[model samples]
Target: MVHPIKVQLNDLMVKREEFEADVSLRSERLDAAGVGLHGSLLDKEGYPRADIDIMSIRTDRKRIAELTNDHKSVTNQIEKLIQELHAATKDSKPSHDRPSAPAASTTDKPPEQSNGIAAPVPAGRPVHAAQYSRPLAVVDGVSEASPASRAGIQVGDALVSLGGASWESGTISLQQIAAAVQASEGKEVPAIVLRQGETVSLKLTPERWAGQGLLGCHLRPIGDTTRG
Candidate 1:
């Protein structure tokens, strides 16, 4: 079944593409008029440049400026939508299902230092949980009978956090994810994702399977998605 979040995402993608196409049209119009986007409208003596169609370029420039501003507004709207989607997802989940950050320990014992001092837990997810788990990567492909598949991570899901490698300060790299999985080895590592707009937390134990990668999934940078 098509997830509502995925449906909304598809609609947004189509809208962004239309915006891109509109911007492209304006660019093409400028090119055809033999004028640069920021080319001086006036000649050396502060007179209007007669070589190019100044009047037409001026009109195009105004439209381009308007479109640019509108595009930013659209982008902000998209950001807000994603935030709300994730927030709703988190809120909707049961308390027991709410996954903890990397700082959390799954053991029965309290997490502590060698001297038995209680370890400090970061107030919240270092990456800012309020970001609604901004996606680190998109699951492009998932092998059947693989750990990722077993964990319920589907191919169109957006990976928000995996094990100890969620993003913070800057973007999280694929290598970091690999390292986190490798370190976990046979242990159960928490996996968080947005599947069809619903936040689903999973446990993925990276062990030997008849698959190629640790999770048997392809993760590409955010926005470079294959599935709608």
Candidate 2:
């Protein structure tokens, strides 16, 4: 029979997965809004640019706020679950094996001091599956004046989904995104990305822009240390 703690951990894992998905979506939205606002709605100093769309920026900001709250709520829930799991495991430890203090005796000479001292035990770090899992592709760089740059595909943004497949769907990948672009033949392809804790949708048209590749961006799988 599965242990009760194991079941609880599994439940927490499922909840965490859901939270991750939500966080990625919110990040994308935030990135898209920021891209839209860059130069168009705000100047370098953050003052309103000439011909700025105040209404559009306001709407984007409101959405970002709502998404931020949602992301925070889910994150707090995940942390609480992790803490509870730690406590549960700690409580499950057998108390009988715990060391007892030695009785004081008149002959005891305050325990002989040792010349060599043991190293201090390091604190245990919280372990979460999310820490090791790569659920999306990361944009490492975007060429200037390229199709991707013009479409607001910024570096550090996580490509969570493309062409209707998402990381949550277990099939999203950089190669899949490239294939979607090639299949589009210069048409607009819908993409969902995670940027700064929000989900944002973008219409990416892979065309021969003033760059090397159609997208003109360097993409690496999340958790991949090597460049491609």
Candidate 3:
């Protein structure tokens, strides 16, 4: 019989795959509507496009959100299962087999001499654990005629930092980037991204264009499975 933990892992994997497939379907619908993955299905004037079914797209987006939540829940369950397995293994050791205390230190010895050696110093200031950077967001799709397209931004690029704010995997949201874009108005914003195996810097400008949104691209948070 398969181990219970293994079975749970398998189930989680299956759920993740199903989530990915659902996201793919949603993306296809967006593409059919002539929009990028997260791109608004609207016009330059902020009006819904006449060529696409807005209600249908809204429904698909809602379903995508539900699937995303389900995936996260399954992932958390898998993590808990793994932790339990680890704890069980540690508990399996016999109490008598545990290492005995070290023999009492030999006769109390005098304090060791400094030997003229200075204590080691840290290289830099300690950073808070919460300050670490994580996968912020990923470029899902880019409009062919948009400013982002003109700036050489492509789909699948993982955005690490934009303007002066850094994105952490679960701490930051796409709305932060949107706010930055709006604040920039029509000016160029410096952005750092991880593309493939290399890091690249680009200047992205958000302005009125022929598409719905200013940037003309779709951005999804890194925590979401719709990264493609």
Candidate 4:
């Protein structure tokens, strides 16, 4: 799901409008100032005053150009995001309420997923104690029987530990620890698996499965057991 808070289309639109307004107002003021300065130079008949006035005008023009570019860039970004938002919420109107900055809800999506590691929890309904459990970690795959499958590790097994480390389900940042698995390729990473009413230890090396290398297991939270 796309997070609306991290890069809010509405907020970007507001900023774009503000910048465009600033550019228009500043440009008009600049033109008026140029006309007034010209009249002053004509009356003064002084080279020093004319040079200073011209330099100041040039500086103002440059600043205006920079701001105009910024406005245009922001406008384009807003347009693109509007298209994306429309696609995501098709047939439904999006909430116009602006989310807070550093949108905790929107910006929390994982950058990438690899090595069977999960990303930080995205915004979702809170998991109650009844719906929590150990997530199963797969450590190896092989040509014959996958280690997890051979050991009867199914999709819903809660992973209880990794090399005896306490497995905190639902909150593991899979993106953060993918490197460790890549580095441990061919080496057995001891995994503590929690299957139906039982937990067992297994050491297995990573192997390719379904295109990407995996230990071939899924995890459920401890709360999943008590959930109706």
Candidate 5:
């Protein structure tokens, strides 16, 4: 027949097993954090960026309670073992040679910034050419030191020709001609433009400029009302 002490030990062992099972279940839940949930914001690559919601905290609280209860039960079992050892070593000094526990880790993340608003670009593409080829609606704040400004191009000038080579009106852009001019050696290039409803000509030369292509002028499209 099984002794009474043996039955009592078996019951304690079952309780320990149950505590271990609870720990394992809690670990599994933590590993599957935020499963199948939509995030509050999208990141630069258009993937969902997880945000901490109060509901997620509530979920974590339940797991933490389970973990705490399991830990308390295990600690009680350890205390019982310590008491038994104390009795056995009554004549001896308690060993102070136990390994120190490691410090728990914490990661305090900084607050996230909002990326929901899409800011509009002023023009379709930024900064167009003033060389006589393409015309863009002249907006206010067009630079005065650009090539367009030096060539008698006003804020209301429409491009017509460059070095006598004509382009389809409004089909060419300022950037393409500027790029070509950037690639060229210093020379006086003939240009034609329509300003205030009159066609005019100018010869322009690029200096070995310090900054990215500076012309000594500013201009705007002829029909643009935004120009000051």
Candidate 6:
């Protein structure tokens, strides 16, 4: 029999994923249209960019922000569930073949903590993304003075999960990540990346900077590589 809290956690995760997907789709539309939240929509001479659809961009940005807030709320609930489950497990009699529940990682060393979860990776494969069991996107470039660099995300880092967007039985879903970022602007989103054979957990706060996109980094789906 499964614990009720675990079932609740699963439901919360599903809710988070729905928020993630919605954010990704809206964010992708904004990207395709070459617009961003809080960025100048005006062109030279102070006129709105003639090539863009101003209203649609605004709508997408607004929805993304709303979803981001909702996602965070759900995540907080999930964290509380993890803690509750962890405490309960700690007091129970030990079993030789016991089940583990997800718990918050320690601030000093997130990777070493949280054994109640799944896989970890760095480059080729995520050495579970914390907030994933698989990566939907991989960090291909982390420019200087950008959010990605600030967050400790490096080149060739394969994200097992970010902003609650993930894949099933497969790896790399750029769409999920695109929505994840869109919905997570100005918010510290929990993520896990595979870095050099180690699972490095971090929080990526997508925000506006002096670079492109909220992250200022390029994420490519697995099998998609940049040509030199």
lDDT of 4 at 208: 59
TM-score (C-alpha) between model 4 and the true structure:
0.31
> For model 3, where is the 10-residue window of minimal lDDT?
118-127
**Lowest lDDT block of 10, candidate 5:** 118-127
Model 4, which residues run further than 4 Å from truth? 1-7, 35-52, 91-228
Q: Using lDDT, rank the candidates from best to worst.
A: 1, 6, 3, 2, 4, 5
TM per prediction: 0.46, 0.38, 0.41, 0.31, 0.31, 0.42
**Stretches of candidate 3 exceeding 4 Å from the true structure:** 1-133, 168-171, 224-228
Per-residue lDDT over 39-84 for candidate 1, one digit per residue giving the tens place of the 0 to 100 score: 7878789998878888888888888788788767765555556556
**Segments of candidate 6 deviating more than 4 angstroms:** 94-228
Over the full model, what C-alpha lDDT does candidate 3 score relative to the true structure? 0.62
Residue pairs with colliding backbones in model 1 are: none
Per-residue accuracy of model 6 over 11-106 as CA lDDT, tens digit each: 776787679779888877887887666677899789988898998888888889899999878866765665576566545646644434346564
lDDT of 1 at 226: 25
Q: Residue 118: error of model 5 in Å?
A: 42
lDDT of 5 by residue, 75-161 (tens): 455435433433443434345542233333332111122642212112112211232224432311223455545555543344455
Candidate 4 local distance difference test against the native: 0.46
Tell me the tens digit of each residue's lDDT in model 3 across 100-121. 3334443222122265321111
Clashing residue pairs in all predictions, respectively, total 0, 17, 0, 16, 12, 14
Give the per-residue lDDT of model 4 (tens digit) for 1-228: 645732575466567557756767767766777553233434365444544366666666677788889876875565455445435544354445422224344334322246444322222222222222344232211223654465444433345444323334333434323444556566556555443333455565655555334554422223333232
